[model samples]
Target: MRVTFGRHKHPRFETYTLHNGIDIDAPLDAPVNAVHDGTVAFADQFLGYGLMVILDHGGKNHTLYAHLAEARVQPGQHVSAGDVLGTVGASSVEGPGVYFELRSQGKPQDPLEWLAREGH
Candidate 1:
């Protein structure tokens, strides 16, 4: 759970800040997959995140993928579990990896909890 959600001191900034996601250590351009069946909610560049994709998994649960090399799905597209959504990319600060997050009813949830539940 690298960079787990919540407040922590920034490595570069030297100040406490909220980190809203986990950074997975994947090589650049490695395929990134959807953890559950969902509809693509957003796929575009976001400040600080680089290229990003958000999946709406219903029940108000959404998953986020950031620092993507490319986004393969479009907004409103349906995706199944294991579907490739993009490839990992380098972020300005995080370097080569994928930043992931889960949210339920607009509140952040620990992705490690989800991953553990799924036996990933």
Candidate 2:
């Protein structure tokens, strides 16, 4: 998995702003899966995110998947971890990749810290 961009203050044009998510570079149409079991909160085109899916895992924890070519889930749908949510698309501000974010109580958190490491 190639992580093109990480959660940080990225320089854009003349100013720098916090990038609340991480961008994982992938081939077009690559499967995008849910990181955890959750109910789909939203599934549609949203601003610069292009086609996106937001999953509410309860307890104020949520995960977002952006830059999708198409969404396979619908709002209010329950999805389990590893379920395919969509396919990677070239709709991101960077390029062809899936932009993922984890939020707790509406605040973005580093996904790397929450994701399981290989072999663990």
Candidate 3:
């Protein structure tokens, strides 16, 4: 997994503060998968996120996959880890890659930490 951008504060943007997620570089149309078992909470265009999919993993844990060329899942759909949620698309502010975010209790968490913990 090539991470183009990571979770951190950006001093360059006047209004933008922190980047709550990581941007993984992938070829256009590459399949993007669910990080864990969850139910699709949302699957549609979301502001600058473009075509995105938000997964609800219960316990207020959620995972968001943005910049998708196509969404394979739908709202309320159950998905296991590694299930195809969508395909990578050039819809991000950073270019052609997937913007991934992990949240707990509605707060952003470091996805790299979680991925490392999962041995990814």
Candidate 4:
């Protein structure tokens, strides 16, 4: 849940951007897991996101997983925290890393603030 930049060269800033990005070290084709309970609302190829997954956590809250090498879930899927949703990818415009976003009521929000201490 902690927002650690997937690539140190590209630090996802908060002052200019509302989203938080990070890298998952599961390796090439490593399994990706959901950080919390949510329903898959979008599962498709996004612009700079490449293969992406969006989960609606309900109550006007959502989580987005992008730049994946492989996606294992589908739209409308109900996933729990720690559920395997996809695999790590190496073809993101942001480089070989996972791009994460937390949205509130369809608007962008900071993922670092929502993550509990000792976040994964």
Collision count for each candidate, in order? 0, 0, 0, 0
Predictions in order: lDDT: 0.90, 0.86, 0.88, 0.76
Badly placed stretches (over 4 Å) of model 1 are 10-14
lDDT of 1 by residue, 1-120 (tens): 356777898679899987777888888889999999999999999998899999999999999999999999999999999999999898747578899999999998888888999988
Best by lDDT: 1
TM-scores of all candidate predictions against the true structure: 0.90, 0.86, 0.88, 0.76
Off by over 4 Å in 2: 1-14, 117-120
Clashing pairs in 3: none
Task: lDDT winner between 1 and 4, please give it.
Answer: 1
lDDT of 2 at 94: 68
Give the higher-lDDT candidate: 1 or 2: 1
Evaluate model 2: give its TM-score: 0.86
Q: After superposition, how far is residue 87 of candidate 3 from its true place, in Å?
A: 0.2
Give the C-alpha lDDT of model 4: 0.76
Question: How many angstroms is residue 60 displaced in model 1 relative to the true structure, after the best TM-score fit?
Answer: 0.9
Candidate achieving higher TM-score, 1 or 3: 1
What does candidate 4 score in Cα RMSD to the true structure?
Answer: 4.6
Residue lDDT tens for model 4, 14-114: 33432355544446677888989999999999887789999988899888888788999999989999999998897764446677887788876656657
